[model samples]
Target chain A: MKVDIVVDARYKSCPGPLLALAEAVMKASPGQIIMLLATDPGAPRDIREWALNVGHKVLNIEKADETYQIYLEVSS
Target chain B: MSKISIIVASEKLDKLLPAATLATTAAVMGWESEMFFTFWGLLALKRDYEPKEVSSDYKVYEDYLRRAVSSGAMPSWLEILEQGKKTGRLKVYACSATMSFLGVKTEDLVEYVDGVVGAASFLSKAKDSDINLFIS
Candidate 1:
């Protein structure tokens, strides 16, 4: 429920949303929660796949209107 | 770690976009990503060179793609590639043969190119990759 960082990548397509989140994660400490606001339809799946590969955790994903609010936990 | 090797053979916007997208995505995903720019693709590595047009076959959709980038919906191909390089998991290589044929010197290439290599050398590096793709 508490968010440590907010990454807004709305309307950016494909890798844009994912890249923004990846960059933010790199700068965050372990266990910090990052909320990514993206409008790209593929962002949720892309983030999940990226998290799976890089050992991050997706806490939750919620859609409001056309935007997706994806919560992620940075991993050590 | 997973590894992806890509052979890029065109300089057109459409070709470069997909190639860069995949390579950068792989790198962002923490995979080892390498791209070999051959023939026309090597032209794209020239310093300050910007791909201005999609392949002629896709002319009808050229404006559509351009609009996406200009409107900020999609990042430019080079921007994507640069992000991938920053991850330290991506390697960009220029083709030795193409350089010779096109008279392109090492100095003519952008600073990120890791090396100029022949087919055999690139193949050796790519042989162990988990995914391999040739994009034109």
Candidate 2:
């Protein structure tokens, strides 16, 4: 699904993308979807675990040219 | 959000970096994290602390390690901790006994240090954490 916020964490390392996503989640309203684009090899697992722990819904994590796009819907 | 509490008890850079890195991850994940710096670990939190002891424990790779860190390829542990603090989910504390022994006052610590906490208080915080770690 299309998202409201797109976090560009393309070249950043571990925790950077996650941090940016966390900040975006705090500012985003419930029912909005957000996407995080990250290149770190650890980002996918981090995103999955973080979303699990924080009660967010993970839509999918797709790969595009060595970068990953993690999508999540804000849980109300 | 989950909770992570770390007890840092080593002076070595290798040992300290992981603790800070994990704390950063926990913070970024929107978890509440508390770090207790005790004994040797307290040195890293000092206002004037410098990482001059690079590779001290890894003598064989001392030159390589120093170059990697000094060249800005790797950020210092303290820098990682500071980034974690920006999430407002990370809190750092100095061990009270260490503070008294080292003659370090509250003002002598970096701004990220929430305060000085004794073992009992620290244990209480750790007790409620979903993930408790001891890094040395």
Candidate 3:
């Protein structure tokens, strides 16, 4: 789907994308999808884990080469 | 919610790295994370907290660690902590007594430090935490 907000965390450090995601996700309302494009190999797992821990839901994640494309929905 | 409190009492880069790693992870996991820098650790919170490989009990690993860090194999402990603070619920605290003894002021500390606290306050927070770690 077309997400209005895209956070490009490509080449960012570990946990950096998580923080970016946290910050970006807050800008959108519940039900809005936020896309995170990250190059950090560990960011997918970090995002998944953090999403679960915070009660947010990750709709899907796609891996293209070494980069991670994650789609997350903000939970109210 | 669970909480994790780390007492950083050393100046070693290795110790501080793991402490920051764990603190950030805890916070990202929806757990409150607190870091108390005391004694030797407080030295690292200074405004000029440069990353260096300091020799600890692990003397044999010093050269290897230093080389690896210089070669980009590792980020400085301060770098790790900065990343943690950017995205996590991590709070960094400097020890009041240590600051007094060292004549360090809040302005002398890194800008990220959440606050300066004493042992009693640190203890109170630690007591309520789910995990407490003493890294020295």
Identify the leading candidate in terms of TM-score. Answer: 1
Interface RMSD of 2: 3.2
**Which candidate, 2 or 3, has the higher lDDT?**
2
Give the fraction of native contacts in model 1: 0.84
Order candidates by DockQ, high to low. Answer: 1, 2, 3
lDDT of 2: 0.82
Each prediction's DockQ against the real complex: 0.89, 0.34, 0.23
- Candidate 2's TM-score: 0.80
* Model 1 interface DockQ: 0.89
Better of 1 and 2 by lDDT: 1
Q: Model 3's CAPRI class?
A: incorrect
Comparison by DockQ, 2 against 3, better one: 2
Candidate 3 per-residue C-alpha lDDT over B46-135 given as tens digits, one digit per residue, 9 for 90 to 100: 887775665457777878767755664455566567656866578999999999999998999998999999999989878989889999
Among all windows of 10 consecutive residues in model 1 chain A, the one with the lowest summed lDDT is: A14-23
Off by over 4 Å in 2: B48-55, B59-79, B86-88
- Deviating ranges (above 4 Å) for candidate 3: B52-89, B111-114
Candidate 1: residue pairs that collide? none
